[model samples]
Target: MNKFELVFIPGPGIGHLASTVELANVLVSRDDRLSVTVLAIKLPNDIKTTTERIQSLSASFEGKSIRFIVLPELPFPNQSSEPPPLMLQAFLESHKPHVREIVTNLIHDSNRLVGFVIDMFCTSMINVANEFKVPCYLFYTSNAGFLDFSFHLQELYNQNNSTAEQLQNSNVELALPSFINPIPNKAIPPFLFDKDMAAWFHDNTKRFRSEVKGILINTFVEMEPQIVKWMSNGSSKIPKVYTVGPILQLKSIGVTQSNNALNGADILKWLDDQPPASVVFLCFGSKGSFDEDQVLEIARALERSEVRFLWSLRQPPPKGKFEEPSNYANINDVLPEGFLNRTADIGRVIGWAPQIEILSHPATGGFISHCGWNSTLESVWHGVPMATWPLYAEQQFNAFEMVVELGLAVELTLDYVKDFHIGRSRIVSAEEIESGIRKLMGDSGNEIRKKIKVKGEESRKSMMEGGSSFNSLRHFIDDALTNLQEGNY
Candidate 1:
């Protein structure tokens, strides 16, 4: 193939888009033969109605050698106090016609339809790929633990007694690997264990397994052999499974600078002031939020920890605000009283910080994260340790994997039930916060630093020319093209 073309799909979050964009850049740079297009597909809708539309940043991806396509125009998923998962299914049903039309066009125009390295959440595409007789590759952006956790969601739900209440009542420690302690189920994202979400996600995952070409994850096989083997060996006709990642491959291709105006957020300016390896960078992945109480609890924790920090606290507006759904909305100002003033000298708070740069700064030593996979990978990529406090989805599992399996994180848990839904207040007391912060800041800090330092080097090496990710990208194209030549498409 003289020029290879592939389409990438990402959910409506920044991390997924950032990584997908990185993948496209790397693929093109690695081969004169490759050109990749990105088709944006929102899980429910892209933004919470309260925040400013993300259009400015989204528009910047209109770059040379890359084409941007929005998942066909579809009605925004109906919003309610309902969990986001339910809204997603409703959104898909409403957009089915538009989705079908786009798929038809894509399949018709493409030459030998190579393969789709899709956000595994876009399950609807499996049908279209199969209809076109092209291979569909499940591109799992999260870690192997999440894939393993999500894979069991359907089975747990099918047990007849595993209701949301049951998952809530049970402990994750017992449900998951033996090494970690239990966390509340509600802290997990609304995506897992909810029957509707499980049905949609798992069915598509299962279909993709049965009918698509193979599984390609953004994690290396050595890092997750048990799950990888179970995946490749489980299916009767499993497509080949390839693991190569910590996918920051674009950095190797010199795709570091963003010329977009939004880069003016100037996060690096703030980082320059902090002492080397002294600031704990705190930010949950975009799309994550905390309840009022959790917000105050974090404020108290940070204040008590007395660790210099840079924090980004951006949460979706409470469900009721979506009723009016306008651009300028009452979103920020969620932090607690005297919180900003008390910590002003010790920490910097922003709506959103340029994360990669902030995490990479020499002044940044550790992270207090929600354990979102991309954040986990990015922190590891930059050689930073974490204070793992997961709040949702399979993140709880990733936290476990990091602390128990990888030894790269210090798991901080507040193992108690919260009275309210968004969980701002239900956290460790001020004392625990102080201790947790200290553990990651001093001599213990250097020890954790050494462990993660090697990981960053390994992560970078894995995507370089002779690396696993580099070679895997090559194999991906050749396999798809050769299969197409044999009349697969």
Candidate 2:
């Protein structure tokens, strides 16, 4: 049997790395002639956790034709004043030479280097892939709706020379093909309000259009049918688009033997005591955290709602530090006085969450989420409806999609951007939080719950043989093999 090798370069974040690794597992499992080598990038902070997770994935897939190789850590950049998007682009650019060296050795060892599957943030590595005469595919960690919005923004920049300042200053709604309703200006990603970040996104979108052989999105057709249909249509401006996902781990990873394991067991046991579909799960993504004021509001809301709940509350990292939010040393220090005791019988609060396990539990009725793409997919996979409280990145847009387009969630605050110096620009009041929680857990949520239950069934079916995502994966693999036969790489 002839052998083919593909190199994967995932972003430094855990969410990005996990999805990329899952995609690699899908590829090698489908085709015995193919193998994947993942080049893991080291994040400056939380190096230990990332390393351990990678180790765990490797161990879980022992004897598989997948390899995990950690790249040497580069010195942290000194440009503190630069916008974060530019800083990240420069940091990844510094890895080009290291990547070239590794790819060179892989080829010299008689491996038929076919392609490079790179994270969306690691687009700088595309130049290296070009140098090695291999095709490059972008593994977009977000949904197709967000990808379409990005392309729309880039088109506006190209055709009308629109600037971030102009977009931020105007209050116009955009009627993009990807969405059913006109997207309001407030729904745009907060990062795009900065001039430097807007330009960075424009450049990245240009590369996505002109450089990549294909773009792989982490969404299934049933989730975003209209947007997927629009992109997959024969369009000259867009590259080949593949929707091969709901690509997530079904079981929990990297928590079996750590402190988290004990915590996870307790949380699961607590859930076991609750009746089926009785608990509302509130968890923000890894970077999601809040100030004392916001935390107090959530606590009050949970108490007033009187619903069984599991809340994962994390403390923000100290100012001027490049670190993730840590579990509160004592969660009570920030929460309302006597709040834990008052809600003891009905709810539990913890630091880090074993999200997959919690969502899969029969007791989980609804999710109060930050609307991260990974969390959104996981919620759908487990048939849990959501209430959106988006904080950063493209989450605001995702919230709009869930509430307006798909009707899969209720809205808490679609455009809540956290200000590091202070708190949110406008604090979401406790009453508002309580209203959302009640709606999500009460009879008002029946319609949304039914929609999500059906969507969740479709999500699973999409991964089965002869389903949309399964066929999409087969199509992607066929294209890669065809390129190899044609000597196009």
Q: List the residue pairs that clash in candidate 1.
A: 188-393, 189-392, 189-393, 277-363, 293-424, 293-425, 294-424, 294-425
Pick the TM-score winner: 2
TM-score of each: 0.81, 0.97
Candidate 2 lDDT for residue 159: 83
Scored by lDDT, model 2 comes in at 0.88
Candidate 2, 138-209: lDDT as tens digits: 999999998998998898899866568777854768898667899887788878877777888999999999
Number of the predicted model whose lDDT against the real structure is largest? 2
TM-score of candidate 2 versus the correct structure, residues matched by position: 0.97
lDDT, residue 366, model 1: 87
Spell out the clash pairs found in candidate 2.
none
TM-score for candidate 1, residues paired by index:
0.81
Task: Please give the distance, in angstroms, between residue 167's alpha carbon in candidate 1 and its true position after superposition.
Answer: 4.8
